[model samples]
Target: MTVGVEEEFVLVDPRSGVTAAEAPRVLELLKDERGVVAEFLRYQVESVTGICRSLSEVRADLTRLRGRVAEAAQDAGCVALATGVAPFARVSPVTDDPRYRRLADRFPRLIGEAGTCGCHVHVGVPSRAVGVRVLARLRPWLATVLAISANSPYVDGLDSGWASARYPLWSRWPTVRPPSAWHGTAGYDAAVDGAIRGGKAIDARSVHFHARLSPLHPTVEVRIADVCLDVDDAVLLAGLVRGLVGTALAEERRGVPLPHVPDVLVERSLRAAARHGLGGPGVDVLTGVPVAHERLAEDLLVHVRPALRATGDLEDVRSGLWALTARGGGSERQRALRAGAGTPADFVARLAATTRGGDLERKAAQ
Candidate 1:
């Protein structure tokens, strides 16, 4: 299966670490660059990779896009931050677009505070029916993925006590929730239409289930993860997502009935992941018992091992998980950096360094 990634980054003033509404300028600088585009908020930008058949392709494309955005942000007198939320910034004004303006008017408070960023992975499926089934199969494991990618720890200059504080904050949108085990494409379409008809979702675009069949492509889009701090981490996620989709597709072909994990359990598991990140305890999707996140990760790997091996990603995903756990995930790394920082500026400095893989230092040394 082919995959792609979409990462959202916030532009921050270099000195103060405040989110800067300079996306227009940064985007202007990136006019020659492909895959980089403005987001709903003027302080944010998004990078979309073309469909990739291998992890290396995803890495190369993501690295290039991140580097371009980082350089563009520097030219605009800001830094492109990969964290899920601005650590210390007030709500940014919405971008000047008719659709965004309509959203702003319809959900003023929600739109005002909805600057959360995320990393979305799309893995191609055979059809919308297959994609919907993949989404249903993916629900039990999405929380673990969220825990693995928890990058946002600080919110509004204070510790939010949630690893991916962006998760709950983003959940303020009416349609943002776990995907349901729909019958097939018709069921999924009906659910989306119902949300729109009931005024919960603005349109098909607003059907923000954590995992959903992509409206624009023949893929299942997984939006459960926060924007990772490193390109390698992002690629790791893409590999795992592809593995999951591949496993689900195989099961579907073998006549596997849709799994029946309870919604309440799924929500609880998600909440735990958001609250504690990877180092904390997680609920087992099957048993509803508290398990360490490491154990959860191990179980997930086991479940997808066949697919991983088939895709030649078994060792890479294994090593990546080990590295992530050893260094602590992005949330823990941010906390550690914040602990050593004498000021918010210093924290942002350290974060900005890792966000772009020390590219700035390399450029400066040159």
Candidate 2:
């Protein structure tokens, strides 16, 4: 199975380090590029990797698209912040799309604080049946993945008291909750139909469960991670989700059962991960007990080790993991940076440099 990634970033001014309404310009430059696309907010842009077969392909695609967008945004006096959310931009201009207009009219609070970007991994499945099975088994580990990718710690120019502030903010969407286990493909379709029929979801696509059988693709889409900062971290997130899906599929073929974890316990774990991230303990997957994030990571690695080995991802997983922990994820890094003399402007500035492929050409002009 192949894995792909979709990431969103906030576009900002190259000089002032503030959200810039330069989506139009960036879109114009990327008109012929299918990989770079506009997002809901004018200050937001998205990069979708082509169906990638390995971590290297994922990294190459992300770097290519991110680098292109950064260059174009810089030429237009703007940059892209690869963090989960903009630190200071409280409000933003919505993209000129009817879908966004209807969303704004109906869910004002939802889109009011828009531009909470995410790192979504889409793992190809043999069919919807297999994808649904993978989704059913993926619920318990969702929080673990979130902790691994918790990038948003600041909002409105201050620490938001959550490792991934974007997680809480984005979860406000009505259908964003993790769904209960399904019996099979029929049950999965019923859940999707129920959400749309009950008005909890706008459409099949809006069945925004953290992980779901993609509405339009032959893939299980994992939408729990906050947009990662480093390209390698992005690959790590992608590989982790893919490994989970692969493990689940293998177990399914072996007639393994999805663990019967309570929904309340799963929700608690998610809250714990959002509150503490990897800096603190994470709730156990099967038992709902609290454990150190390091231990939780070890447990996760054990679960996916077979898949990693089979796919030649064991080394990347090991090394990428070390890098993630060594740097302490984006939330930790952001807090540390804020503790220093650096401000929100500086935070966005550093992220812009990362998005621009490490050549931060445009600084705050004197």
Candidate 3:
């Protein structure tokens, strides 16, 4: 299956460690660049990769696009940061778009704090009906995915004691939640229609389920992960999500029954994953019992092992998970930097360096 990735980033002034409202300038510089676009917040920009079939292709595309955005940020007098929420709060004005303006007017407080960024993965499916089936299969494992990709630990310059504080902030939206067990395309369409009719959402785009059929593409979009600090982690997420989808598709073909898990239990697991990431306690979706985060992650790997091997991503995903365990997720890394750097300025400087391809640059230099 072909996969595509969309990553959002925050623009900040490296010296002051505060967000910068320079995305318009950055977007102008990247006008000639394909798949680079503005986000709802003026201080954020997004990079999208065209359909890719391999992890290597995902890496190459992200590396090149990240490099381009970093260079443009320099030209725009800002630095691009791959983070879920700005370490310090400074809400940028909404982008000059009518839709965003309407959203701001309709929900001032929610949109004001909606500066968070996330990584979205789109995996191609044959049809909406098949996509709905894949979404059902994906529901139980979404928490594990969130845990693995947790990158937001700070809110308003303070440690929130959650691996991904962005989850709660983003969940403030009325329609944002874990998707329910949908029967088919008809059921999915009904839910979307209901959300709009009931005024819970402005439109289909506003139906922000964790996983859904992409309104603009023939794929299943998994919208659970925080925007990763490292390009490798982003690639790892893409590989694992694609594997999960592949496994689901195989099961569908074989007429395997869908696993039964309560939505409330799944939602609880998501919250636990957000609070602890991979280093603390989490709820297992299958058993609905408390389990170590590491164990949940292992279960995900085991569940998708066949698909990973089939797609030749087994080794890369395994090694990537090992690296995460050794070095930690973005939350752990951010906390370590905060403790060692001694100042917010130093912390943001180091963060900006990483977001701007410092590690990739070092590898190339060596």
Clash count per candidate: 0, 0, 0
Go through the candidates in order and give each one's C-alpha lDDT: 0.89, 0.82, 0.88
In model 1, the runs with Cα more than 4 Å from the true position are 358-366
Candidate no. 3 TM-score:
0.97
Worst 10 residues of 2 by lDDT: 357-366
| Full candidate order by TM-score, most accurate first | 1, 3, 2
User: For residues 16-106, what per-residue lDDT tens digits would candidate 3 score against the true structure?
Assistant: 7688999999999999998899898999999999889899999999988998998999899888888889888676699998878887877
State the lDDT of candidate 1 residue by residue for 65-156, as single tens digits: 99899888888888888999999975578999887888788788796678889999999888887788888999899999999999999888
Question: What are the per-residue Cα lDDT tens digits for candidate 2 across 1-366?
Answer: 899999998877654556888888889988989998888888888999999898899989988888887778878787777788787755578899887776677677777676889988999999887777788788878988989888888887778899999888888888888867887899988888998788776678777889988887888899989998768788888888889999999999999988888898889888888888887888886886779876787788889999999999988998888888887977887676556435555655666665454445234211
Could you tell me the lDDT of residue 155 within candidate 2? 81
* Ten contiguous residues minimizing lDDT sum, candidate 3: 357-366
Score candidate 1 by lDDT.
Answer: 0.89
Candidates 1 and 2: which is better by TM-score? 1
For residue 230, give model 2's deviation from the true position in Å.
1.1
